[model samples]
Target: MLKIEELQKRIDELLLKAGLPRHSVNLCTAPVGDGTPYISFENGKYNYIFSERGYEFFRKITESTDELLYWIMSELAYKIAFKYELENRIEGRDGRRIAFPKFIELMTKINPLWKLKAEDEIKKTLSASPYDDSLYL
Candidate 1:
């Protein structure tokens, strides 16, 4: 089972790899969705929100413990999430930092499977735990 704290660490790692400061993830606020693991970023203009369908897929991979399966699932999840970010647009707040949408898009395209795989792993662990809570995005 994946603990929330561990999941958070994985998230932080992804954010760092994505070129987003690790501080961006607000622990005080809910990161994942109602039933899925989703993240939302807001600047001055628009809010960047995305779901973690990849996480659900990840849980399946982890359940089996097949490294190759896990790798493939992880790769796919990140690709889908990154693609969503890329195709979408976000309003930049200060005009200095890259808008959340743009950042997501760029990260996804560069290493679409990186952060996403980690996120999926965490989400899967969360869902499988005894205290299961639905977090659908």
Candidate 2:
């Protein structure tokens, strides 16, 4: 039930805030779950991980975990997305998804090699399943 409009709405809500809790922080990415999305405080910043418990998410084509994680991220997520201006990164069929590479860059402000670890895992799952999210990935 998640839509790009919804995601943009969430991002817009945060943009109204003007800033985040930490001026110097990174929203790092990793294949923490099976693309379920997770929020964890690591090092000096918070990590917004594309999550899962393993392959359960990969095996089924169910509701979008991206929405679930955004929910999990709560207001802090709003602030981060607001800080990075996630509204600009969203694109897909009817604008329903976020580009993964730019998403990683928005967090780490560097090449998205770290996202590869997570992408590799997601790639394997998508490869085995009937789902082909590469267009959105």
Candidate 3:
């Protein structure tokens, strides 16, 4: 299971280096199929797909996709609590049995500013979310 505390620390460090605040990110999650792994964010609104396979995929991609490191970190952070929930097999007590938005929320807070090479698909993904707007602004 991924440690939220450790991941958060790393995020904080990244934000410090990026010269951004730490309140811009607010992680939030919602139900998607049996499980989902798509990351999304809007103005004060956040949604992402979550699943075990998604986590594994992230781990694999993050390992080799250093260019997408920030996105990978943000994605991993949001999934931390969810990972814990799954690892512990804890039941949903407060409607968050599987929801873990704090991770991405942290990223938004840090206001990560990354330089993503302009590619149709990448631009579409980043622009589609509030991430690029927040980062550039």
Candidate 4:
């Protein structure tokens, strides 16, 4: 299980790095589909929800402090990109569009090693397993 305090700290750091208000972001648990975690913005607060399986996945990917920080930052980038699109804010406050390519570039610039490692971890998780029975369904 991941420590809530640690996760919250990482979230706060990511928010700060993204030029967002730390007070506007929150970490919480909620029911999510397919074990995927998601972020929600309501009442001027951004709630990051983690399902049981999502938390487990997070724990697996974030084995160290540095890894955890990188992962959270990457997630923040993705969420920001999505939010920009949803709100039709193609040009952010800095007059630059926040897109997936930019997100990836930002992540890589933050820590190339950590970003590559994160990608490998995700790839491994998404790869098919030998014990596959869902195909029958």
Q: CA lDDT, every prediction?
A: 0.40, 0.40, 0.42, 0.53
lDDT of 3 at 66: 29
The window of 10 residues in a row where model 3 has the poorest summed lDDT is 56-65
| Structure candidate 4, residue pairs in collision | none
- What lDDT tens digits, residue by residue, belong to model 1 across residues 8-118? 565566656656556454332233644333322333221123335333322222222123223433443454555554455244322212232343454454356544644
Lowest lDDT block of 10, candidate 1: 57-66
Badly placed stretches (over 4 Å) of model 1 are: 28-104, 107-111, 114-137
Candidate 2, residues 24-101, lDDT tens digits: the string is 322323455545443444343334445456543322122543433333334343345454545665443212123333
TM-score of each: 0.29, 0.25, 0.28, 0.42
Clashing pairs in 1: 33-135, 34-134, 34-135, 34-136, 35-135, 35-136, 36-135, 36-136, 86-105
For model 3, what is the alpha-carbon lDDT of residue 6?
44
Instruction: In model 2, state the lDDT of residue 47.
Output: 44
Stretches > 4 Å off in candidate 4: 1-3, 29-61, 86-98, 105-137
Q: What global local distance difference test value does model 1 have?
A: 0.40
